[model samples]
Target: MSTWLLPESLADILPAEARRIEELRRSLLDLYRTYGFELVAPPLIEYLDSLLSGTGGDLNLRTCKLVDQLSGRTVGVRADMTPQVSRIDAHLLNRAGVTRLCYCGSVLHARPAGLLSDRELLQIGAEIFGHAGFEADIEIIELALASVRRAGVAQARLDLNHPGVPRAIVDSDAALAGASEEVYDLLSTKDVPGLRALQARYPGLRPETTEALTALASLYGGTETIARARRVLPALPALHRALDDLQALVAALPGHEFSVDLADMGSGYGYHSGVVFSIYAQGWHDALVRGGRYDGVGKAFGRARPATGFSLDLRKLSGGLPPAGKAQAIRAPWGADADLVAALRRLRDEGEIVIQMLPGQPQRLDEFTVDRELVLDDGTWKVRAI
Candidate 1:
């Protein structure tokens, strides 16, 4: 019934919140820059094939697609900026060494992915291309932590996992190989009964593999979890390597609260091949920042390279920060006095916000806080703080 109403989960950001979000965006971009991440602004829309390239099936499902009037081919409004950045690195830049890229913009989702998730998100992140060691993973995770600290969310919790852990366990067991998706869902949701049923299906599998598959459901919490995993999990090469990587990450991030969770896999499992992480602040129910190693994400672009990055919702991160101070406004009366015009121009040049009143119009204090007023005192124009 309301013609001017916004679509569900899509709403306008008014001036106050918009200003705060902008400030946070600038701060984050600056942080990324200090770490050698060059700023990149990818177009909001692109061909469906490229947008979904190497991103994963889940992204395709989340993207909002439309037919291009000029090309007659299906295109999609980006639901994520990572793949676009991957294309830039793999196809456009074609650089062999490590290339650091950062981006901040809105991505439209076909539907809200979570209860409070927006159809449009102001996503900001940094990606590192061409490094494939545990050191690269450590760097990105530390950078993400520093970003949260920079955003004023000091009490942040980091959760780390390697999807390879579960993949190794599942693949090692022949009976469970085909039903990995069902098994993953059960583990992700902590469905104990379903996992028990799964273990029952593979009656003749090796004791260690079966034990590890069932143990995945409970491998969560502090450093002790990693220790427990090393003890319980089979010594398969992939599984051991995943545990070692997680251990190395924990050792690097000293003085920060973190957990080793094998069951923390999400929809991006196929895309993020190693060392997944999510950061949570004290007040937020959802992750303030998330990323991990999606090495070889550039494969589809024809030159596969190791890549890892993290993104945070500007609005959500700003929501956890203290309110920003309002800019001081100096109210100036309309006049032809050369001195007054000169003073107004000087103030503007000095980065002051001066609101000039219209000729014969009344001053509206409600429109802005008049911190000061420009007036003629003793035949000389001056600015006096109220």
Candidate 2:
């Protein structure tokens, strides 16, 4: 094997894609700032328990764990930043009022999320803590939509789900006490046959209960799905509330494509105590963004706060977009003359790309195209078209 060969699901991000990802990161962070979201950066690696706090087994499995040499405790490369941010909110900031935070960093997944996904992700997201109302959920959702739109992604669709909807049904059957994981797996895929087979597996499970579970598989569409869910599913208050919450959110957010999937509530992560959402768009193989209300995410940090936020892989976001054009640069001859040095500094300060050539340097460029040149024309340094 070539020494330079990377791991199966990981690879280095090249110049063009890296540029696009960085630009998008800056743009989205600025967008979050416009909404008063303060930036926060947690370590790339931290104690496993802290990183996985309030999250689910899926995140644990995705995390790459190792023994820390300093403390001899098990630490893991962070697979998600939400929990770390939650800890900061619950323990560090300790603010009584609303606290908005945004983060952007690299996370390592133990394995590829999908065939096309890389093990390394440039995860960027914004979170709102200390707010419990649907207004917070709406803000998070609106921010998520704005993220992809700002990245030039068109026709973005919002898919909303509440784990409570499925949780209510799962809890209604006492026989399903320990089978929540299996049930989540089956429903997320809308596997009706699997739900039907559950009856035989758990003999005490009711036929009507299984039917209601199966009904959820077909209860997906536009706003009408919520009304249809009310009629088809059992009249459980918890279940209805979940549906109503979705309805209220839909009402709150208008002029965007919305859909509901009671069967697929996304990665509950064991912390999403309320509405969860995923953003999908054309050109991307998987969801472009995922986030929502997880009120108790801070509980594991000893202070549960009403929290809602969303995150997206900048690499994937950039991958779906058109190629980034090479930056236009001014070519300058190698010199340490005072005037030339001053000219170079001025152009750079003005946000111009200026490349200084070394003596006998080869004619090559990777990220910049030399469209203009700086020269001492008529004894005065000036920029001229190439």
Candidate 3:
């Protein structure tokens, strides 16, 4: 057995990486605030039932569960933040009108057998509750696209889809009733062979149903792909409406690139009652951002609210973003005097990163490789760049 005690699929975020992640998060959160999204933080742990109510299919199965020591009741580490935010809006905020909320935190999930998964993920997202209209959807999409640009994700594409198409097809074909989970998985991954096998197994399915499923299996690419898909599955009303909504979104966000994938592009949460999307960057294998409409999730917690939003993985975005600044050393030996401490605080408050000196360290701050040094000389403070 290995002597190391680290949990499977989970790792620590060291200082350099952590700092970059936080800086990106701050930029995104500030952008959210400028767009009128207020910040809110929910507890990291919640009762298992409340947490599970916010997810569906594979997500519910991946949650990490445990017994709360004090309450003696089962609790779960949140697999995502959307549900907790829903609970807050419905139960606490109880605002009569629309409310915009944003959050940044870590969510936990267990690695499933035969699947690639990360146990710990840092998410930053916003939710717009109590609004239901194509305008709202367009605004959310634009905001998500804008945030990705602000985060330095060059050449990002938003792949849009509607669960309604798949849901409608499945409802018309009895064989698809209990098969949504498996079919959706395959569609999202573009697993054509698997989809063909599924089609063969359910041979009694109608031609239109099969055609829609097959179209989804092959549906992925740029704007041209969406036009081709429209031809392949011509009779789908739900698909048509979804496409129209997406077209409106694209028009609203002129100059930004996007595409529509008819496939079940993976649902955001148990509450996502409408359009869903995943964002892809040039170098990343998976989406850097994912979100959609969760029209009824708030109602499950006790109110009827129509809302939508997207969450970005800060760490993932860092991987795609260009390096910000060169690594600079931090000064030390901040002196034992109160005035010296005040000087250090001023630098820190001014947004400069400061490192305090350990005992018996070098007295001359210039001995280090820092970009700048804050020092006290004759009861006055001086800052000099190296």
lDDT of 2 at 306: 91
Residue-by-residue lDDT tens digits, candidate 3, 173-212: 7877678778778877788778778767887767677667
* Alpha-carbon shift of residue 240 in model 2 (angstroms): 1.0
Off by over 4 Å in 2: none
User: In model 3, what is the error at residue 62, expressed in angstroms?
Assistant: 1.9
TM-scores, all models, native as reference: 0.90, 0.96, 0.86
When sorted by TM-score, best at the front, the candidate numbers are 2, 1, 3
Superposed Cα RMSD, model 2 = 1.4
lDDT of 2 by residue, 96-120 (tens): 9899999999999898877888899
In terms of TM-score, which candidate is strongest? 2
Q: How close is candidate 2 to the true structure, as a TM-score?
A: 0.96
Q: Provide the clash count, candidate 3.
A: 0
Per-residue lDDT of 38-117 in model 1, one digit per residue for the tens? 99999999999888887655687789999999999999999889989999999999998899999999998898867987
Off by over 4 Å in 3: 1-5, 112-117, 224-227, 234-236, 323-369, 372-386
Candidate numbers, best lDDT first, in rank order: 2, 1, 3
RMSD of each: 2.8, 1.4, 3.4
Q: Global lDDT for candidate 1?
A: 0.84
